[model samples]
Target: MNSPDDTHESTVCPGCRAVLPSSRWPETPKYNASPECAEVAGELLGFEVENAARLGYLHQLRIDAYGGQHVSPDAPRIGPVFALNGLYMFLERGSGNLDVRTAHGIMANSYDDWPRLVPPDRVGELTAYDVLIAGGVDEVESALLKWARQVWESWPDDIRETIRELTVELVPERYFRR
Candidate 1:
């Protein structure tokens, strides 16, 4: 962990209780050891798990999704864009780390499990914006699935078919033509 003086110390991971003495960077999630724990970390932070498994691949996919050319000095980065109750999300880490924005921003990203405790329907006061801001191809697929589900049984046949075609574009080679 980092202190105001730029000194570091061993800190316990909130998700797995691991001592992150050698973490590459301070504020990096403790669940780096396993995909499942990574998911839990996001869950504990009131964020949805997007592209948890095979994160390295997810990182590449995010870069490809954003149209990349030159890679940064740092290797891979995990900028999982997690939605808060099927709504707004922290889009990306961008350069380094994120800030605690409008109390909602900090509250939404905090380690406290407050959002999960509140029923999604009861929180009508919170404005919901429908933007995927997918961080990777898999995340994009998941978003499409979610959108389809919301419009299912009522949406036009052509729109549903269009979404299906888009999803097909990202299917891995091994899963293609099935």
Candidate 2:
């Protein structure tokens, strides 16, 4: 067995398929995660939590973007749907006005019959590594937004239309005027 101190060559994440350094942790089967990708995700989560004050409004956006990219059929169906809708609210709506509680309620109520979504073959080129490497708050925020946009656009055309339809159906009309 490889010890935590042992270093190995790069491995690919099963979720986003990003080539990443081998994780110190041994690989164990997960729904849509691998050791390396999980390690990077942990690092990004740490950064977001540590710098939540500096991250401000972008915190949820970053989380949703990452979640959207890493979805799996074995996971809760709401994961991808919620992430996509969150991205749509923030990116397409031009204002992050969709209340989280309202969105959650809508999803819980309306999405029970929705079919499970298959993750795209390619999520996005940028990963959490890109945001983590950005030196300062401004740089990190920029990187995070860029990554979110790319991930949002990476979904299939039909899936994106579903996101739009869901948003229009669930969100309050007033939120869209802005």
For this target, which candidate reaches the highest lDDT against the unseen true structure?
A: 2
Q: For residues 6-124, what per-residue lDDT tens digits would candidate 1 score against the true structure?
A: 44555443322334333333243322222322332333223223434433223322222211111122323211111121111112221111221222243335433221111121112
- TM-score, candidate 2, is 0.84
Candidate 1 deviation (Cα RMSD)? 17.9
Clashing pairs in 1: none
| Tens digit of per-residue lDDT, candidate 2, span 1-178 | 1347757578777777877777675553433767777777667777777888877578668778878888876777777888888888788876452454367566677657565777788888888777887878788889999999999999998998988887787767666534
lDDT minimum window of 10 residues, candidate 2: 95-104
> How big is the positional error of residue 53 in model 2, measured in Å on the Cα after superposition?
2.3
Q: What is the lDDT of residue 103 in candidate 1?
A: 23
**C-alpha lDDT of residue 152 in model 2:** 95
lDDT on C-alpha atoms for all candidate structures = 0.27, 0.75
Error of 2 at 115 (Å): 2.8
Candidate 1, residue 65: lDDT: 22
